[model samples]
Target: MTDTSRRSLLGALGALTVSAAVPPAAATASPARATPSTPAASPSPATAATSGPRSSMTFTGTPYDTAAFARSSLGELTATVLPGTPVRTEIRHGGQRVAVLTKGARTVLLPGPERTFTENKQSFTDVFDRLVPDPALPPAKRLKPGWGTSPSGGTWSVYGGTSGDTDFGVHTKGAATMLLKDTEAGRYATLTDDGISDADVNCVAAFDKVPTGNACSFALLFGYRGGGAHYRARLSFTTKGEVDLRVEKVMNGETTLLAEAGPLATEVRAGDAWRIRVRRKGAKTQVTAWPAAGAEPTRPTAEIEDSEAGLRSGRVGVRGFASPGCTNLPVTLITGRFEVTAANWETPPSVTHRDWVRLLDAPFDGEWTPAVEAIVRGWAGSMAPDVFSYAMMFLPGAPGVRGADPRVAGADVLGEAGYGKPDSQGLRPVGADFHDYLERPWTFPDQTRRPEDGQRGNLDCSGYVRMVYGFHLGVGMMAVKDPAKKALPRKSGAMVDFAPGVRVAQRTGSGGSAPDLGQLQPGDLVLFDVNDVAGDPEDPDAYDVDHVGIYLGLDRAGKRRFLSSRKSADGPTMADVSGASTLDGPGIYADSLHTVHRV
Candidate 1:
């Protein structure tokens, strides 16, 4: 695999686009190449290098991106993408399309469709058969028809004349797992990758029936270059109920055992799942296996160093083997999932602020809205899917302020009149309009709101800043009470002057001076002195900063916008309910935009 060859392969793939049209019922002849249904301009070098040479497929969406790999004649390939999901190209041979391919943020060569195995099933119901329909053959005969049966009790169904008689297929249950359909002969399927030398491959699988002897096993394969050439990590159960893990290198059908971990104390029983991991880096290869329900072991179960450079680079795959010595009856192996990750493939991270904004449900130029939602979810330790609501809980009694519960509108304020403080008439101090939650209960002063009530989360301007940078993202924005620290200070006003990530900027006062906007990025923090409280020249450190918000790039009309929790909105918002969250126009908070920080 040379650079010139990889570039040529990508060029061939660049011409193909994923189509939404349903696959043809029968195997179609592999055209010389597929033409784009909707032609677009070629990607520039910059655009082509946006993602790394990494791809993923979850088989969640419709089968796409197969036009480029439809020429595979080794076996049948079929895919099914659930409706309304994004298109992800699937690799399904043997009657099930279980995975899709997704490019990483920095990709150089997108993996092409492969020619391996046959048939595919998906999480979707009603898997359409992609094998050529044989009206003359019965259903059972069609399922495993072949030129002849191999030594094993399996037949090659898709590739009828192939010498191998082992049956290789993935189960169509809850999650797709490649099933070894009771075969003494080893069978494997490979993904199509170009020049992938340093790679990691892993999967979770379990034995359907414990082997009577050592002849049955599940395997992880890498550096596969077709025709039985690759590296394999084999895990098998012994008669003593222990597990045997080993690594082997195969070249053109010749097998050489490299490393072996003789039977281990860990007992393996039928239906007990284990995660097997194998990595090939340069001339060194390592393998590890552990209970799928437990954490992966820190050390490899078996490791071997081979200076053979021919086993340097290729694709990744899976294999299954069973013999008569292991079981008199037929057995099946269930593989829950499979994954491959290529390391050391570097490319630039070029996702733009505008791109992120386009994904948010907010109106034009409102990408920061979802970012804020994501931050809030991080703070709550609950990142599961939910309705986009209640980013921040404002102090009770702020107009329209409420928690996730409609019944919990305001905080339970314990007023000084009700308590022992006779000098103060209200729950908060005099001239202290906004009470910072300070990472404490948002239901402070009264402290009645509990986590179950959903009213206990709250943050003021500075608290929100600290939550985003210091607490959630660990940006070292010192805690609110730690005014003595050298890092970004606790209060909003202090941050405007002494922020660690502070960038030089022109200030726009009440008189409305045009500020420099070129230096700002989307995640930067914008500070404001909305009340002109910074005008107290004598005590600059003690003066208050009115507002702070997360900068969102530019809106549809080209106005710079930000996202923040406000008393007017009673929670986080990017809307114009109180004042537009913009900074450049004639909006209310625009004139108060004084400084910016990019922590």
Candidate 2:
């Protein structure tokens, strides 16, 4: 609904009939005095005159009731009828002493300072009636009862008795006013209209006398269905000005109350009004209420969900009752308006997915990072010392470091193949399989066997790199398990060659031909082609990329440093390197450098 129309409806909801209450203190302040007939543009101070007697008048507390006098040509003024006077009442304002009265004739005089007077003849009731409308007859509407069915399995007529007295009935005074009397001491009388079913129903009722006593209730019914077996919701108000919301199920003439809320505090009186609205969207139902002349409340008075699910839409109307010991008084409920409309429901939009490169490009705002280098640095700072061990394959496992299970030996740790344990030193193993370096003649040798095929707690250089980058950093470059297969593809040089973000550069003896040292970022792998098993020099034809280390960027002295799992003595330690000759004494780098790969 448009906000303006909704506000108007809400205003109508809270509008109450004005009462005969004392005016607030602010209203007793003196009214504005009139300006003199002088040529000066500014207004003059009010002239002091004899103080008038206190008024015995009472005012009706409706707002802006004197609007007619405010808009009249005579301008705003108040008339006070004087007691013990000779047929005269004072007319005030305009800096004049004016009065209108009758002595065998009617007269109006605007007396001047020299006993001179100006006279006019006008009716008094025409002017004063605007402030207080005739109170003998109040404003109200007359309604003819509509026809509908009752829960007693019989035909029903509203405001009229059906064939059997067991059917619902209503009695009206004159042609249009219905007096809902609960003649049956303890029975509830309900009359529903034959309105079409709708998803949303709003019913506003004006009560002439708010009901009281135990079991006394006046309610609005919505979502009603079936003849005698149906389900519906109710918003009931008690004479104590408490409101209750309830949902019920009726089957074979029996009623079951499902859900209820309140006895909520509200302002209600014998001659006041209230409104109730019910709305259903899918399985959720909401009910709301407000004083007849107030704005719509921000939240629902009661909300409920029905999963039993039967009647989704139904008729709407009014029902009331009083208990046995309660006074059987006549209750007249007048409906100002009843509206039914389709529910308004809007769906939210879905989120779009982003790629890995886009994720890496996202801002590095301290809390989040996408690159493996950042992940490694964060892990290194948080992990306890000696957590990483050289020549050991640490598969995902339970908390503490323990030996691998032999039952799943040689099985890929991709799925149900199982994981390995950390070494007894509480260090995370860095190898997939163990290689005898004594016989291999190489510091960092390529892994020749899968993690499952090697001795427990052993891994080669490549396996260490794979575990740290793939398992620790969760990079997708690692071998992913095929959903239909029992094992994932083996990790080999071929997989690394085609891994995501992996860029390889052919090497030259000069070392300058490799990735520029100045441009290298952390996590870059420095690959080396070391001497073969025979202890001979490197051969281009059989140049196996045997050794690698993760670049950890420049140290305090601006020299480059990298971390790697070396021999047992060094374990996983950081090494400093400057140029080819200045490279510190380490297992494999002591031989020679070849290609470098950024991963």
Candidate 3:
């Protein structure tokens, strides 16, 4: 999964709309800007994107037939990556040219416009036959005479046809349909097919009649190794419209239940389609089912871990069971369609990166201006992400703002680091008062009464912003020489009034004032009043504000997510470890949002 050519730079929160006191060890590198430019050769249209919210779609196995599954799933052919070393092919479905395949090399050359593929500067001219050979599928056969047309090019093996009255056929209703009927007791029907070990199987099925007394069962069977030895994930319908799910291991003629999900809340009718999926990877298998028309549940219904070597790999199929009392009803189960795919299927970046590009195109009232866009571009072109990630690095037993255990007398770790108590200029924490006793690289300026780290700096919220803008980007203010204007005071509250940056948004309230997101953009400084501190009449702008973070763009759920260094996570994180990086709704700092600045 490692790509050596990835050169995406870290975009810090836009530009320094304000200034802070430069760190003593700040780098003297010249500030860089993201000027407009174009690549030498335009990349082909992207085939897929990765920005979609998490999906429930699971695969049956990998190294399976891509062409057959692609046709079966009816999903657009975005891109395909053949896993290998020295030679791996990444084929983008559209466009004339495909990317090169070689050891430690990826290049695309103009191979003369004849729908050619390039590899190591060599032209694979019009060799579609060599490029995409029809893959060899596993051996299979249809046992019954009227089993109907299998859309998978006849790759299916029939089983459990001892009773002559059992029937099977394909109808025109779905992508691939199986029609089943049973006429006698203990009579069942099954359609199986061979595939790789790790796989994903999905289908929609329903019964023609409700169970009155005897239970009617349908199952998606996997790990089959010949006559009757396999794992089956079954759904049994009973007398009261209730459905129970079970995972069972069958050996010879004996059946053993592995896992069971008691009756579910969803009720099934005569023609209701219940979409079922079976995903088996290594020793773990998961089964999920829901109404085909409804949203898929986030969690699996039944799961099992079978490490038995005897049932590790096998074919997958569908099975139906019936009793003599249900003969007239024929115990009908209609499976409308089936789709199978490899376990490791994913899209390329250029496709998904377009999602953020599209988001930038969205119109926000006072946001999304040309100047703001340039600043955002500059931030992305900078080393912001890398520096931020460095600050987030884990350092076990690292000293932080909270000096040490007070139980141990004179346990003043910060005092040992040469930091002193705060002075009269601003609301600054003494060395010992600023820490949460967490393991993080927390460094602040010497004037802020913090440590001078020879290693990675230990940073608080405002200290982190200062490090990024002042130390890393080299646009920060110098040390204070006058009392008239403080050099970016070393506190979140002080930044609001003293930091020389554009105030993006501010609201004065008791608390619970969320910023108007439409007026905000990526790279903006997001400030918060975590404690709802009592306001100060003398210093209106700097009062109440106590925390700060950098704004990232919208997440998959379209929520405005930001990045911050904090005590709860013991480092920096955009994830919901303690609370999400969002401004409103159930997050920890959601109600504490106070003001915003562009720095």
The CA-based lDDT of model 3 is what? 0.43
> Compared with the true structure, what per-residue lDDT tens digits does model 1 show for residues 1-599?
23333233222222111211111222111221121121122221222222222111112133234443233323544534323212223435555332232211000011223211000100011111123123344665453321111110111122111244334432242232334444546655444332445655576777777777545777777766664678888887665668888888888778899988867545667888877776656667667777787776666787788845666765555576775566543556666555543222211111112111111121112122344334322322211111111111111111121122223224211110000111111011111112223212223222332232222234445655554444323334443323433344556777766655435364755555655766554556788867775456786556546677777556554667666655443334444433566887676778777776544
True lDDT of residue 118, candidate 2:
9
User: Candidate 2, residues 125-164: lDDT per residue as tens digits?
Assistant: 0000010111222433211223222111112223322212
Whole-model lDDT, model 2: 0.35
Instruction: Single out the weakest 10-residue window by summed lDDT for candidate 1.
Output: 117-126
Quote the lDDT for 189 in model 3.
32
- Give the winner by lDDT: 2 or 3: 3
Give the poorly placed runs of model 2, Cα more than 4 Å off: 1-178, 183-198, 307-310, 343-599
CA shift of 405, model 1, Å: 32
Model 3 alpha-carbon drift over 4 Å, by segment? 1-154, 162-166, 175-195, 323-328, 343-599
Q: What is the C-alpha RMSD of each candidate to the true structure, in Å?
A: 28.6, 42.4, 25.7
lDDT of each: 0.43, 0.35, 0.43
Q: For all candidates, what are the clash counts?
A: 24, 16, 22
